[model samples]
Target: MSGGADLPGAAHLVLADGVAHLDLETAVFNAMLEGWARQQATRFLSSDGTIQPRISLVRRFASFTNEYPWQWDSADVEEFINHLRARRPSFAVSTGRGYQNILRLFCEYVTDARYGWPRKCYEHFGEAPVQILHEWNTVTHSSDYEGSPGRRPLTYDEVQGLFDAADGRVEEIRKRRRKGALAAMRDSILLKSVYAYGLRRREAAGLDVADLRRNARMPDYGRFGALFVRYGKSSKGGPPKRRTVLTVPEFDWIVDALDQYVDEVRPLFQPGKHPALWITERRGRISLRRVDEAFETARKVAGIPEELDLHCLRHSYVTHLLEFDYPERFVQDQVGHEYASTTAIYSGVSDEYRNRLLHRSLKGRHSALWGHCFD
Candidate 1:
């Protein structure tokens, strides 16, 4: 069982176990290893249906078998990472990070306890990968993207414009309710609430119409409460909390949409079942795939030609909250992000803003009569 000699691979496991086992490529092996570790050590597991991501990480790192501990030296890692960079897949940094991270796990799983981080490892992955992750800045990592300069928040006017446009879309779509778009509008309102009031996507998608009902939790989440989604990607292991800032009018729109879908639409869609708030027309409860497609359809309808997905709604939430003068920690709380408050995202200043501050510092420096040291 030492040094990957007994590591289970499809080609070899059945040789001893007498059953044809699923193939475990290096990436897949790492995934199962980590999942075992988490269960044994931390009780950590993703919500139902986490296999897709595990599979995705596997397929992306398929060639790791060739990068043996010895062959994948400093230069090999550098070349591999550079090759990954050139491909520039939307998730390139992620893919490269994935490759290294998974391989690191593999080394942990298979390497003898006696042989530690290779002398070459420090030279190649300096400061250790963990430290690099602790200090990495996404902006610097992605500086090569075309026109990905520090994107500023939309002005108040633009914010209002987005709201107005969303509202207009709702009104127009209202006329076409026969198209079963009440579900679409319901989802749009949910997305808008998340963007405007800062609901995490999973929480938003997980909302039950019942969750928003006054006295729904029997005075626990409180009347006129926002539903808290806590178990998914955004907030892991923490008790969920509702937003206290939603205005009655703003909250009402989401409530109205949910009500319409449940009373008129949901019955037509589902004769007698409702486990989740976002239900499909026929199935009673919508899957994550259905929720995502709803978002995609609405994005196209709203004329946002670019890749406007859930994460953009989240980014929009964070950026707009900053413009609205919400404090760094407060916005972080709303979004359920742990490290973002200290990291650049919380109070991340734009380079342009930093330069402007530098200019102001110059003015202060020269404000003294001779530009000498201030008394």
Candidate 2:
């Protein structure tokens, strides 16, 4: 509240609508948001640089409600989030964040209602109770939002079953006389690459055939061999990042797909040049959408509806790796995450692991030394 944080600013009372219209002092609003954004940098959009863009989002909502003075009182914060989720066509976690980031900006600036700001904000968008809304509303959150259910990774058997089913299901598509034979091949490679490595869709789609290979410079695959992974979309701040993930199956499968596309199918496209690893035969280029649809169709054919989407593949991959007891550092790097905590959610794969560390320690060696309880 240092920079005009306490000022009520200019106010116009809207008596009938039960809300006040406070004209925010531009400087005060800017400073407030600037501070708040910095305070919540871990939230992704909390950086100082995010202030203006975040403000734009808040203003956009203000344009519609143009009701003036977005008080936190007339409505609840959580209600506003819910309304946003409902109004938007898709309520993916990413979308929910659009609203949260804006509101967080508001929270930084406006601490009180020139009148009903808090009530209105709460009424329209109920207090999230949790920073990131969970699956119940619209899947959005980084570290398990309080009360917001999060995704858990699938077991090795489950991931293996999905991959196995995909292999068997390819023959089904071929039997049905599917037109895109290359599409079928694409599906196999996509699943193998994503699930085997727990890759984000962007990283997978963003690849180029030239990206994979042994380089004496980086030696990402080590001196003996090479593999490539360009992590185009990152969960952490800043622009998409670049990292080289070296894995034999991941390298081999992706290389095979590239060969099929360029050596075989890509030649069918009209004369044009593109660098993306995944591209359509239509000439424009293969895209994230084509990859999505291909995955969906393959899932339907395989009949594993519980977990079949791209990220679901990620979930399965992470869980399977955890089950195998891979080092957290290695997993973190492979997943392109900045820290072990970010990837810790995958540890939910088993209570056995937690019990070994938490519960088992309670029993210690000298149980009869004194009165004690597991609590």
Candidate 3:
């Protein structure tokens, strides 16, 4: 074909040419995956995290079906989904939907006539691949928030206990002359910063010293007045979203904590010229796994429920901000949520806050009847 190399997915190229008899099917399947990877890369999907998992999922689906793309049908898709549901500790609804979406995307790529996969399959196997995942068969996104029910905002007391536990770890390490005191201190500040700024794990880990910015209005806080988050979650096939999370007055304690870490504690690690806000013992950037481990350790020490993860700190931030009487739009912007509805989902305001709100409403509307009661 003309301009074969110029095709979106390199669909004009033959992949299974000169393959051994027993390896032909495998070679063709591998080629299809490679082509898909190329296409996704062209669209700016991350190879390390996004494209690899997609290719792996396609391989898994193929393995389950025990058939090539041309032989895959609606029954295969349904059966595979049923198998997923039947497994011990079955996948979450959102996870199942995500799997189906990936499979559907792969099917769309292979069945498109312009991609030449369909024509190639027909020539090789006497049948073209058809899209197996359909609207009726696939999982529907029925819920706005499909995350784990166990993952809710921590109560105010719980947030305090968690932070105290993290601080205690630092103290314990220092008392025992443990090697990880610096790391413990970093972990303590990291967890606090996560909640203080309503940061996702990656966003916090991806932070550099330069990300700390000054707010013109909040000069007292100096460079800690705002966080320039460059690693906000990305949309499909897009760069990471960026936002500036302004330091709110309620969480202004973070300013001093961050200042001490940046000025005094971090220098002990000898992270010479490393721009990372959080550094490891080896003077490298702290990893995401380390962040999780830190939170898990503190959670256990604090006797918090096992279900509450690092992300719960983020939920707590949203909830606590709402409780502190911040506007919903302000909370939404702080957390980098695209919609106020998403901010609402993260918020689990305390019963005390709700009761106070109710009392205020009643006192405002029926001062004669409710004013004395509130007092």
Candidate 4:
């Protein structure tokens, strides 16, 4: 293989069947993958995420067809998608559609004349790769909300129980003289902060000491005034978005919790000069997986429903803010949603709150009718 340095399996498989000539098919396939990777890297301007999963999808499709991209057609794609649908834990509609979309991009890239893959394939193998995915065969984005029905906002009682269980974990560990007491304390505060600020897991994990700022209006809360989120979700390969969330009166207890953690418990980790708000035992920033695991462990101990996950804390935040009669646009901005409709999807107000709203509407109507009758 002439370009064997970078390709995963290009070392010993260059000459085909003891032939004197280099294998054109193997060389072209590896080149196509390399070109696609470079294109993505240049487009995104950073390689933090989003390339590896796509490459894995290409490899899986190749394994399924046992043929290179040039040999694929619509029928092969249809059979491969059907096989995925028939698996025991079949892929969700959104998952199936994502797989198809990535494959479509690969085909588009390989068949484009500018990349030279089509010309090289034609010159060597007498054929070129063509797009196999069409609109009729792929999943459509039918609704704004496509999440599972089982997942919903946790009720106020459930949120309290979850927090209690997390705090209890710290005490339980400390009583036994165990080693993970500091880590548990960090997880407990981290979970509370997530709900307090209506934050995504990544946003919570990306926090630094400087990200916490003081609110002039709420000077009594001191340094735990607001959070400036630097890594809000992006769209269309854009840079991470940014938002600032102020501390509300309802979640003011978090001020004390955060102040204690920053002053006392965090020092135990010996994270000298590290800026991350949540420090792991290794003296580095905690990963997103640990944030999720901490939530799941607390939920199970509190006997909460299994469907509730870390995102549910954010959902609960939106729903409770709505219950407290906060404006819809305010809630949307707090959670960094680009659209109010996206924020609405996270809101699932309790029946009691709905009834109160209904009563208020009736009372206003009744008062207007009485005035009209008297006049």
Best by lDDT: 3
Error of model 2, residue 119, in angstroms:
24
At residue 53, what lDDT does model 4 achieve?
82
TM-score, predicted candidate 1 vs. hidden true structure: 0.59
lDDT of candidate 3 over 128-245, digit per residue (tens) = 8898888899888888999878889988889899999999999999999979898999999999999999999999999999999999999999999999999999987899999999
Could you give candidate 2's per-residue lDDT for residues 319-354 as a string of tens digits?
A: 656656677787777777776776775445677666
Top candidate on TM-score is 3
| Candidate 4, superposed: residue stretches over 4 Å from native | 1-22, 88-90, 370-375
For model 3, the stretches where C-alpha displacement exceeds 4 angstroms are 1-6, 14-22, 368-374
The C-alpha TM-scores of every prediction are 0.59, 0.59, 0.94, 0.90
lDDT of 1 by residue, 190-294 (tens): 555666545555666666655654544433324444554543342343334444333233334555554555567556556455666666656565566665665
User: How many clashing residue pairs, candidate 4?
Assistant: 0
CA RMSD of all predictions: 9.3, 10.6, 2.2, 5.0
Query: Pairs clashing in candidate 1?
Result: none
Decreasing lDDT order of the candidates: 3, 4, 2, 1
The window of 10 residues in a row where model 3 has the poorest summed lDDT is 1-10
Name the regions of candidate 2 deviating beyond 4 angstroms: 1-60, 63-66, 69-79, 82-98, 106-150, 164-173, 176-178, 215-227, 234-237, 248-272, 347-375
